[model samples]
Target: MHLISQLCFLLCAAALGNAVVLRPRDPVKYQLKTPPLDTPWTDKVGRSPWPQYPRPQLRRDVWNSLNGIWTYQAAAGAGDVEKSPPLLPYAEEVLIPSCIEGGISGLQKWGVTHMWFGTYFEIPQEWNSNERILLNFEAVDYEATVFVNNVRLGRNTGGYFRFTFDITDQVKRGQLNSLKVFVFDPTDDQSIPQGKQTKRLSHIFYTPCSGIWQTVWLESVPKNHITSVDISGGMDGQLNITVHSNTRQPTQVKVEIHGLESEYATQRWGFESDQLAKISVPGVKLWSPDSPKLYNITVKMGDDLVQTYTGFRTIKSEVVNGVRRPILNGKFLFQFGPLDQGYWPDGIHLPPTHEAMVWDLELIKGLGMNMVRKHIKIEPDLFYEACDRLGLLVIQDMVSMRVHTNARPSDAEQAEFERQLEIMVNEHKSYPSIVTWVIYNEGWGQRTDYFPEFKIVDRIRVLDPSRLIDAVTGWEDHGTGDFLDNHHYADPQCGTPYYSRLSSPYDQSRIGFQGEFGGLGHRPEDKHLWPVEGAVRTINETYEIHANTDSYNWRAHVLLDLLKQQIERYACSGAVYTQTTDVEGEVNGLVTYDRRFVRVDTQQWRTDIQALYSAAAGRA
Candidate 1:
């Protein structure tokens, strides 16, 4: 088998004349002058930066990861003028995927609003046989312009989502190819989905991150190939698969499902164009927080072969006894977990490594939590994959825009917001773990007059009907969406009553959820701290909990007591705690920012959290 694999690699290399040049590892070196909050994976980042394949769902064997040292220079203006060509002996070297503000990127300067990144890559000669060579960017903040061999490909706006371009015509066949990318992020200036990023970092908002913050890569695909595949599991032991292709010719989609007990069961379906293909599994294994069972699937269409996986599960808001409870796979499972901000101490928006991302999810699962509200930030696809595999529910929030004025947004801004919302749903709709989509969080950029919150909910429902929708979390209950979500802090006694008074009449159809609550700030022990430059000395100072307060004990006790109170008094179906981990100045996390310490007693916290399941089940 090893010999056969070697022979196959040799043949592929031979077919691609630039065998040695097309190596995965880049020769350029980068050293972080000032490391920021170093994790176990931080040191290994130089050689193998996010070595894992960027796209997990659509896996292809032949692809190159363009995530290593890249030549970078801080440019003037908002990238309005083309200062230089794609050719470069750049001013400085920075790590790809990590933004300039991050210490791991080597250029930790914050003033850089516009920058140029240049790198050279060798395209395998064999890849030329394919009609198109795709250059993919997992994410680039604000706006990004791509130049292939000094020839402009295109520009992509919106920082959070992924974008791709075809560079087949501009690339050199076997020689090294030059790739240049110019990025401009007007953090708070533009009404984009900036999440919680701001120039003046204080309170909830953290330091602004500019340029590319996710993986960049290249892939070669045939003229007629599978573009994307949307997979959703059914309650009736059937899988609904939609194969979207860029081909005009008739193609046959071959699907092979592999499970623990079931062997590779093959099925074929013929389609003239992009079509829906259904494959039934007699006894499908349902995925849950207890048992995360994923069915590996291999899809083949002509020369294109893609590897993917999907878990069988269904989510709905059903009345259990009198209260509307969230039903996961025919069970009224009260989703209780932390509001995960998805911010990393080392990499900010991006994780130090794939393992680091998985570790956070593992901790969430270990804490006996079944769900996580991904608070106001869109994470990489891998984050959702980890949740799916670990059997944790995710309430994916749409990155919010910075609303400065009371006036309604311009038409252009509203259009852009809708476009991003559509893209978010389309890109991540397949993830079974994403049980609910939280459209608006505490009315951050919500305007009911021009762009009604209800309209956005309607649009999201049209795009993805499989998952539940929280139209507006916290304050404004627009009388839309599947849940009446609210945010509260520390004192559950006063908070629950305030929530009740603010709440509209009970709608039996829609469930009630405390989307954000229990922000009991706890400062980690001194030894586990990796304090940033402007970070607060203690969380108590921010939350005004008094300097002498035993914060750790208070935080833990408050969380436990609130969890019980919310379940019993409010009769709430679900709740999301303030956060999973500390972020910058905001030290109200269950764990520290460096991920070195858990402030609360994990064994006891787990037991307390698990008690909610029993409590909720008894209510049903």
Candidate 2:
């Protein structure tokens, strides 16, 4: 059988005009370099970049953060299951939660496919009360397999979702316990949902981040604790609460509602079953950009307790004045914000600090924008939490892959992509800030063959009926879903005609949305700009800085005014600007890549934005 397999491999190679199989060569050793650029928080990143509790939705006071320095070894091949975990007195150290390729990690090395991360932690004496100790990773790039004291916990795939393991049995009570993680990230070399990451960075695609890129921590909970929480049905007076527990045994759960507004009193309700229950808010305060009201919820099941917050709001597409538009809280409020690509010069996918994350959202709110399109990348839950708290509506994009648009993915790849997509929706649907789900972007990895019959968008709707779904962000629109979307660059345009690349024409039945527009890049100052060595520079509408008129700001206002006129001419609901910040090589940003400077006049732009919204309201 071995000989036959070898013969088949040779025959296939010959057919493909390629050489036969050979032994693998030793992996290349790339020199690591420190990044030149830095954010405002870089100097203050300190020992722990992310010290906050990883999971804000499910809060617990009894927890320990495992986010500091860790030793890591890198290799350039697919991980082997037969190989044992590396025994370490490792020479190199990387800051936990930052990708190895990131400068904030202290080692900016690339081309690493297989990586091993090792650290140590001690279990507190207070956490030994018949509780299950859970080891949680906020996110790991591509694939990760965790181990404790050489005992393998399990494996988790997907780069942008949180994964956890119950490590009660593996951890010691008082003494130190060793933790090891094996990570595999092939970047564009493999067929996976990688968003805008590419090994060979060019144009829109930027540097690829491998290994852990978010927070890691530990939490203690009861054996029968609540595993998941789903908060929905905010449209009506009642809010739906679904609690998923570890055990299937019948148990009673108590829910306490604390209103953020002082006018309402705390309400308590008891449920006979842990699965699902509907609780009524005494004063149903509809959450909107104008009035963002949040309610704190506490769930208690015997010894297990968890806290989370939700807002009462509803999102839908309805016809107003003969044009379909986004109706938030049953009102016609035009949504407009930046196309936020949550990348940092220092941390890559992960921001330098939580304050850095909030800074972008705060800037958007301060600019008088009501919504932001999180372009083709899933941010950590804290980002969504900030949006929720700051009253900015979100249009979340699913990560795109490197798959060919004309062909179908392998059965396994298709299943995995859908699985990650489902997980993204399931995990983040509870956030009231997220009102729309963008399933595809510009046909990046979209499968055109699987169209009308494609149940992926339908599945997302079933998973989350509360949010509007963008079936395809820019192209290959199936004429289904909630919005008719298009992408225009350098300048703004409406989604009425479906653009040139889209498969179908505009559907008046759906809401018209300009997915992307108005890049309007300004040349960065020498000290503030990212080093342009091997970076690919694509020329757009770039302007020079002028002190008198501020040509950059003037250009931005002109384009925004044009956008307003186009929205009125085309009768579109809203639009997303090119981006919030300039990514690597993509200079079209309202803010620079390093978060150092703003290209536009903030106060003037805020006034213009208010005028845009006022124009939209005048039509209504």
Candidate 3:
């Protein structure tokens, strides 16, 4: 096994590739927001703001909290675009750990995209030179650049994955040091994976988020520290773990395994060359969606220790018992669940809280869904962690920034799009719950900006051969992708089984899953929503006082009824219900926008879901 991130940084150098580059400073920017919280005991002078522990995967003690009220200013979207803007008064005040666009961030999640944030802190004189500094960002949209005082540290792209910078050399002990970050995001632009984010909130897409969407903090580590680690164990009685370090060489590297009943499991091993080790046991326990059994894992190169967990499972779409089905642990199991469009009413791109992350799947479980297709947007890693622990299967979708905006990057744009896509694939390829990858959603932004790109089917196939990939979701079905899929709005026509029969040459199923259906509307009251609710509106909000949707609902309900008719009519495979909750103005979610109300009774809804999934599981 190699460093999970070995390929993550192997960009063809500009000297070799002669790539065109842009100085992000060319765009106007906004300074950061630092709102003062009103906590009775959470005053800025005393308590540590955002003092919670950072890494949930590997827990530890003795770290510092860098979140708190900080100074900020907005840069002229035009003036001196290449340089940080000077501080301005009454610019904006917001909470440290929240994005400038999120409600909790003490900033609105609307009408703001370009901005910069800065904060200053003094290094404690008592701290020794033996300690190294680690500056971590949970997430920052689009592009980011970091500077200490005035010296450039490092830069990072890709909004989904966590990025870090070593600032030890820039910070002088016993002296005040300033940290600054610049961010720019074209919400609906043809670059970057903005997921369903839009400058204007509506329909399915919610408000856009700029700057930090997650948490930011500072940590002190020994000079020789563990940079990163990838822990994965497979079902064939094989376990693979790799550890990355900041030093050139280490004296020793070792890891211990536990949880398996066999004594061979609870032992230690050591190695070098990126410090990865492999262990295989005979007759290992296999993990399935039904029984999501995970094991404990520990890693240590020297003095540093990191703990995590891994599940042993393999996913495949197979014809078992003469039926095309998603096989898990060597058994046919219908993958069924909500189309999880991870969004929030108040926070937009940001989930309101950490627990806010689990509601989508918890509601799915309540509705008897064993699996979920996390449509179009890759969620924060915590969401996957919950799926791994909660026993729900996930078909993760890669984000699309240019899809809705009709972005047709010239061959140049297309090339950049591919690069961004590669970043997405490598960053998220490791999760156990992700059984499939969705290359395109409804062909939103095709390369032609018109026709479909059959090559997409091939692109997805190459990126992640370990899992299933769907090149396009709604229309223009290419004879590629691991499965078949289509969208039906007012007629819930679940697709056909004959299609599954056509892919036998590839050992793939012709049957396509209903990538979308069942968009029943039910909005929440007093949600403080953004203006211009999406076009997916009732089309006539008051046409019928008591009716679902005067234009789409009554017909949508009848369409769902029609779909149920077709489920048994076509003898289909499976489906992913339109959405889990209402986003912005679209009220199609199973739960209301506030997440406080369930549109349908929990038990009855679950039963409805179970029937659709089980029936579609086996495509004969």
**Candidate 1 ranges with C-alpha deviation above 4 Å:** 1-29, 79-86, 126-131, 248-250, 263-273, 404-408, 493-508, 525-534, 537-541, 544-551
- What TM-score would every model get versus the actual structure? 0.90, 0.91, 0.80
Alpha-carbon lDDT, every model: 0.76, 0.79, 0.60
Encode model 2's per-residue lDDT on 4-26: one tens digit a residue. 63565455345434445432321
Winner by lDDT: 2
lDDT of 3 by residue, 22-137 (tens): 22221122332222211111122221234556565554444566676543445546333366433221244445666566545555545555667766566666655688777788
Q: What's each prediction's clash count?
A: 0, 0, 19
Q: Report how far off residue 152 is in candidate 2 (Å).
A: 0.9
For candidate 1, the 10 contiguous residues with the lowest summed lDDT are: 18-27
Which candidate, 1 or 2, would have the higher TM-score against the true structure?
Answer: 2
Q: Which regions of candidate 3 fall more than 4 Å away from where they truly are?
A: 1-55, 58-62, 78-81, 84-90, 122-128, 200-202, 222-224, 246-252, 262-265, 273-277, 282-284, 404-407, 449-464, 495-511, 523-571, 613-620
